[model samples]
Target: MAKNTVQFQQGFSLQEFISQYGSEGQCHQALFQWRWPDGFKCPKCGHVRYCSLKSRKLLQCNRRRSQISVTAGTIFDSTKLPLTTWFLAIYLVTQSKVSVSALSMKRTLGVSYNTALLMKHKIQQVIKERDDSKPIASYIIQLDGAYWGGKKRDGRRGRGTTGKLPFVAAVSTDDQGHPIEMRFSQVRAFSKDAIIEWATQHLCIGDEVVSDGLNCFNGLDEAGFDHRVIITGGGPESVKMAEFKWVNTIIGNVKRSLHGTFHAISKKHFSRYLAGFCYRFNRRFDLRQLLPRFSFVDLRTPPIPQRILKVAELCG
Candidate 1:
């Protein structure tokens, strides 16, 4: 008999993670591979030859003699933390079914709360950037909009709460009804224009989009997708409909995970947090691949200070 496998199920264990990436040398070697798969070419002069300056722990391009640290120009650039700590953080965030909180990370990594918080945000941002370039193509996408953190003292629900941030969720499932990919983003609001832009950016022609008959979703009219609007008329019965199975389940699980993990997340950085969930869920089939996947992205992604992450989100 075949047992059901949940999204978080994977073979990578804690002992395996520690054994594979326990030391600074191990992590450094991994980063070196991710950074230069073919061979080391100087970013400045493109020279293949390089020599390590042991005192400064730098790789100097033989031709230009430019010094490049292993962390140079990467997400870990200008960090005093060891590569092992960063690698452990990546493992913690990617492996957990429920997200890990900054405070919990502080305790786990033995770092200060502020440092843990910064590291968490940095990794989430990398996840966001990695998923940003992926769009739904040739698949039936379940579309829904959700509000987070809008619990009010008056016990009001759904739309127009001071604390709520609006986000749209989309999931692509296989013929057998298993989720394969997910796209989520925090938006200013659920309006026609907003949905139009989202559809254009994240959706493609062969993709069929299914959304609850929210009038705003009509924006997809010219989005070049075969779109269907199913209005369940707002009730448990409607939500139970098979048409919405994957999307509804995903939203429920994500909300629950967020609630269980963090004490509270502000609206500005909500998109990054959502990305963390989306990244994990979208790649759920092979959770063991997450560490290497994230390491590659971190190696490729541009560096940004903690200040820039907040400012960029706020400005957007």
Candidate 2:
């Protein structure tokens, strides 16, 4: 009957965001501090002394004379949009409980649909890169597999169904079974080999992994995890099982959130979209810090151009 503190907590307000990063100058200053907290240092030579090239908005190294723009090499590189637009985009993406579609972003940011989509993907790339680097290491972990995409008219359904994308969803819980950290990985298939590979990279050795009795999950034990199998056979009842409660709930939320927000998700970019949800979920404890934290990571993330974003396949 008690209120959930996390749900009720004060988040970063639009007024506050505007006060902090209302102008291009404010965004540039914040980016500068995030990129170089100590002071200006040449990226090429690591020299401490630098002079500003106000004429072109670049910083020149005193020793090497090499010039670099504050946005160079970051996710903002070569962007024709103002830093204010980028900052507002970050605010909308990070602060939204569910995800924001590019169409909505286009209307809000007043940019072309393609440009909005590019910005969304580029920001999601930063989030995906940041979250993908932090693997889950916990004592009690709930694991489950879920599929994305619409249902087909064909008789095919469930695992191995045509047009469905298989992904592994996991949530690390506390002793009382409160979900903490989470992970969502898009795998080629939910086969034994695929499960093993994903477990090796995202899960830690000796962690307790509780999952449904899917044969492919047998790979968890082989991969050095203390695997606990719960055979809650199909239908709605399986999702109600206590042992897999958190994982199932998270998977449900992800499916509903993504399906409700975006009209379509490309096969090549599914991982990044999944990563965006995981990133926000893992950091949900502090809504107030989400924007600044995301901004920091965005500044450090390498540039992802339209060409790279258009790649046919992902490394996943």
Candidate 3:
């Protein structure tokens, strides 16, 4: 990594984003490059040769009579919104420290509330799917938890009971001892199995895991994890590990970003939102280009009936 923070800072402005990718066709081309870096291939026939329908922006397959659009088989498939709006939404969400709300995004992008909500959810899902494929394999992993969403009124913490949920996060340290890799999962119960499952999925075994004195981590020895518990009650000497500081800094950043930006987060969809937060936080350095480079691939297709049922279930 070349440590280019300029892109992240410059692209944070909405005016700059509109100036760069204002046209739907330009946004489509950028997505096309992201989907097929080498070239386009027919999803149906697996043939690379295709005629470009310049008028409709579609590719006519040479082997088959069918025509395919660049947005086919992606999240944008069948979407009525302009590609430029989607690009701007992705850029804005990824660049912001706190994830933007659908309401705010609707106002910002001049789209309907429902459209903004769907766009936010779809982009967040894409980021989650992409990041989930690349798990954090190595490095000093620091684990901690934080409770979000508390109201403050008249100089009090407001009973600290705003129905906020608890989230467990892990951050990896770089060679220079700075935090780099990050992962977060919403937790209902802080049990041993829950912690171990999350750790095994996102991290490799034998990686040095540091946490505070929590009984849930006591079983890591049996789970084949190199785990250590730091008793903060033992004064500064016990908390001497720099890795712990890095983890604390990550947690603090998440809290500040969430509190300052979104204001409040619902508990029902907390995990998905947490995943989006972690995605943005991890890529905070190169979000400008990376954010625009994301495309919705058909990695996993939800059955329409099942998706509808799940939505109904959640609504109920």
Candidate 2 ranges with C-alpha deviation above 4 Å: 152-157, 311-316
Instruction: Report the Cα lDDT for candidate 3.
Output: 0.69
Give the per-residue lDDT of model 1 (tens digit) for 225-288.
7889888898778767787888889888888888777766777688988888888877777888
lDDT of 3 by residue, 1-316 (tens): 7765644365446677777688977787777777667897777888988888989878899998579887766776777888887777887677776778777888989997767766777677677677677667457778876566655554343123344576677888766777777888776656688777667677778688888776776656668889888776534454355757866676667777666656445566567677777877677667565655465333232312224223322210
Could you tell me how far off, in angstroms, the CA of residue 43 lies in candidate 1 after the best superposition?
A: 1.4
Ordered from best to worst lDDT, the candidate numbers read 2, 1, 3
Candidate 3 backbone collisions, by pair: none
The total of clashing pairs for model 2 equals 0
Q: Pick the candidate with the highest lDDT.
A: 2
TM-score: model 2 vs. ground truth: 0.93
Return whichever of 1 and 2 wins on lDDT: 2
Error of 1 at 20 (Å): 1.8
lDDT of each: 0.81, 0.85, 0.69
lDDT of 1: 0.81
For model 3, what is the alpha-carbon lDDT of residue 158?
Answer: 19
